[model samples]
Target: VDADTPSACVVEREASTYSGNRGDAPNLRGPKRSKPDASSISQEEPQGGATPVGNRESLGQAGINPVHSPGPAGTGSQPVGQEAKELLLFACGVCSKRYMCNSKLVIHKRSHTGERPFQCNVCERCFMQLSDLRVHQRIHTGEKPYTCDVCHKRFNRRFSLKCHKRSHTGEKPYKCKECKKVFTYRKNLNEHKLIHSGEKPYQCSKCSRAFRRPETLKYHQKTHPETTAPRECEG
Candidate 1:
């Protein structure tokens, strides 16, 4: 029989009989419950004696097989026709996003609920994950754990170090889809996009003149130094 065929698979429900002894298996014989709906079965449950309902080929790719099992039966039970191998997935209630484990799902739910459990002792700033909180604490600690081999420049985060190395390699990985122009940094590419859209988001407070870059606006503001307010003392 083809493994992919749904009709080829058969579910064998395990049954136990009571002998009124401590070592005896619990009596499962009761009023016959209806067959469990394939969709309703919890992924956390053991897959023993469970038969998948759909085509094995398509289900195998998704890392889960929709199992269906009949109601309780006699003590004598046969093995399931096909082995049901699946990785159980835990889904988020708010966003419907799925994870491999309940802990990951709990962590992912924080993004929707805005729950930050881990906090930095120095800044008292909270983060959703412990790793993020640890990284944030580095700002107060002044710890640069990641170092560059080329220029000996150090960065607090590994990603910052990776981007820094690209400067030495002359790697311009970020490309403008419209003009096919490449940029060393994603921020520069984003700023270049403003030229195509003709959007000058940074406007001078002193005048109606606007610029695509904040630095350009700052340069323009230099012309209005007489009108600009004096800097307050830090004290």
Candidate 2:
């Protein structure tokens, strides 16, 4: 769906569920499964099939917030009922995740338990099914598996199919209550808090200098060699 949808639609339309290699070549040719019903779109059942999709608390509480988000000033939540039309699928292998469309499940079945019965001549990666193998072969030949609906980023994996929803929505579910700053990434939010506390856990051995991130410390150490040793100059 477009950015007009809910504030924390963290997952995208395609990647709601993952479809990996089934890990079975012999059983790959088994009977095809039926498409799921159209009315089945809801919070995914869960990974182990423990709670039914309708019963999950976190899926609803953390995802797809019903209320509108606070804008620059006094703007209210984006009205309810504005949702993207997503496809649906059914995973019979007893997994908790749900799919939006029927064809998706058919595609998803390829990735369970090593089911690559089909073979590609150009590359030896066996595919559980044909279409997936086609998608994979595109990799050796360098094909864009999927293009983003927004922005210039392209990915080879469909699991990476949907572009990061936060980029467009600008909804930072992970927030630092101490500073109240928002971050698109959870790790970034965690790092930002260090600024408030003035904490630098990562340190460089060569220069005895510190940095918030390891990369920064590594970069700073390079400057040590080019510049005169401060300790020697002082002596």
Candidate 3:
């Protein structure tokens, strides 16, 4: 069987049957989110911080096209042969997110199931996919395969290298709808969204300080004597 072939025959059958009734189809991961316009993204020099911009040239290169996205959130209907591919696709029951590749769907299913089939031999930390395990292994092995072409900094994962490349290219693909701020990555925008909503999900166990982001909460917790005692010795 081809490497891309679904390991399970049952999933292939289910995906094919899923196509019979589009109305009954569960939600699937759809196209990439639309980006802000190009004029908003262009900068003379790259800098840290999120901003809103459009034009998906950068995201398109990353295989996240807003137009051709395959999930339910797509703006238009699937392109030619996409429907058939979906029929042969595996979908997540929780989110109804579909994957054309069975392996991808299997890995995605782990997000819901919290199943970690892959584990690190050294630390015994678990991962949902073998690729993730391999990346985790890099920490123990001190292996950095991916490097930044500009600054020569190295990374264990290819995506990290890609994100670092943005520092050089000045690409900010994620944007905020309210303040019109642009972000180099989507997670930064998500963190920024909490500021506007005034939603504080990360709360300190000691001081009862609420934070929009976990990093902030973690930093705030350091002020408490109990948490910083161990780190003080390590340093």
C-alpha lDDT score of every prediction, in listed order: 0.79, 0.65, 0.81
Model 3 clash count equals: 19
- lDDT of candidate 3 at residue 108, scale 0 to 100: 86
Better of 2 and 3 by TM-score: 3
Report RMSD (Å) for each prediction in the order shown. 26.8, 38.4, 37.4
lDDT of 1 by residue, 151-188 (tens): 89989999899999888999999999999999999999
- Model 1, residue 208: distance off in Å is 4.3
In the predicted model 1, the residue pairs found to clash are none
lDDT of 2 by residue, 1-235 (tens): 6677654544442233332433433343588877767555343455664545456465466554446533467564543432322222344465644567656665566566556678888867687677778777876888885777778677777655542656787767788889687777777888898898999999877756688987787778777664555565563
- In model 3, the Cα lDDT at residue 157 comes to 92
Q: How close is candidate 2 to the true structure, as a TM-score?
A: 0.33
Model 3 score (lDDT): 0.81
Q: Rank the candidates by TM-score, best first.
A: 3, 1, 2
The per-residue C-alpha lDDT of model 1 at residue 52 equals 49
Q: What local lDDT does model 2 show for residue 210?
A: 81
lDDT by residue for model 3 over 1-235, one digit each (tens)?
7887677876878877888878887668776687867655575333563322453555666677667678666566555676565575677789988877888888888898899988898999999988889999999999999988789999999999998899899999998999999999888999999889999998888876798888888888777776445545563
* Model 3 spans > 4 angstroms off: 1-88, 226-235
